[model samples]
Target: MVATKGGDRVSGMIVETEAYRGPEDRASHAYGGRRTRRTETMYGIGGTAYVYFVYGMYYQFNVVTAVPEVPHAVLIRALQPVEGVELMRACRPGRPDVSLANGPGKLCTALAIDRSLDRADLLGDRVWIERGDRPVSAASIARGSRIGIAYAGEWARKPWRFWLKGNPFVSRRDGMPRHVRAGRKAGGGA
Candidate 1:
């Protein structure tokens, strides 16, 4: 959930995520221990937000998952609306509910996330993950290659992307295993 400066709260179910292991992962900004002004936040303790701008547009939101200096982060790829749907709609006019936060960039737009939120603590009131009513089962979690990182060579093929099986909100469905696509589970459930 995210509470804006205006006091409107927006929340979602994290339907998709992609892990970027640091140092050895070529696709990671912190690969080879390289650090810069933009990547400083990633070195913080776990639960820190590593928000960054990409492609001259779009701010991508990531959760720093590693201990200090390790730099591992998970990119929040898609979310299913859980609260403040109307506010999200206004932020992303013309999009249907399902499309509102189906990608990293769109997720940021719908949730009003940006570089301004960089290094924010996920445990803070401004942004925090809530426990959903129903827990997702491990059997229903599907893994695949990270998207849009073909430049990472062999590292791009890592099965780091994880999403609920058969979730429409997942950014890309084509690479999912055939068995997962054929499963009976659907959105918001395992």
Candidate 2:
């Protein structure tokens, strides 16, 4: 149930995600005492959207959840490209199919997600997670802190990683060896 890029309707599946608790969660951008016009979205009711531009080149998507003002969000790490392969690839070319949705910015590019859809209701026709029968085993999943933000300090060590257990599509940062990244995907039978 992956969302379509061309205003075509499709459901978005929750494949791989990472949770960042506000304030207490150091890995979160809305960490304690940090607030901005951009972060203002993070302060709003959970279930809202937190889309932002990065590198002036790509958009990173995040889903706000938990109590309003709690500032918790699950970074959509990756999507399996289950429903729309051709569409995803058209938006994101030059990579293996698996790599299409492997990273945050990459996922948006592949999924055709952008700032225009920011704050849009995910439960609506344009986007949503249709129930699926994917057998994501616990053994196939993995856990670890998130990537690209060493500034998180102690929060950097939190094991908030969730992936499709043993799924090879999870994006790994550069320079990190394979054996060191063993992760267990969670919540089987989505």
TM-score of each: 0.89, 0.82
Separately for all candidates shown, the number of backbone clashes (residues 3 or more apart, or on different chains) is 0, 12
Clashing residue pairs, backbone N/CA/C < 3 A, model 1: none
Q: lDDT per residue, candidate 1, 1-190, as tens digits?
A: 4546368789888999999998899999988988999988888899989999999979899999989989899999999887888999999999989999999999899999988899999988777787888989999898888888989999999999998888887776745443455356677334
Model 1 TM-score is: 0.89
Model number with the top lDDT: 1
- List the lowest-lDDT window of 10 residues for candidate 1: 174-183
Candidate 1 runs further than 4 Å off = 1-5, 174-190
Tens-digit lDDT track of model 2 for 1-190: 3565567643334567888888777778888847887777777776666788889999988887867667888888777667677777778778888788877888888777788766666676555555677765677567776677778888777778776655656776322334343365544333
RMSD of each: 6.3, 7.0
What's the true lDDT of residue 180 in model 1? 53
lDDT against true structure, model 1: 0.87
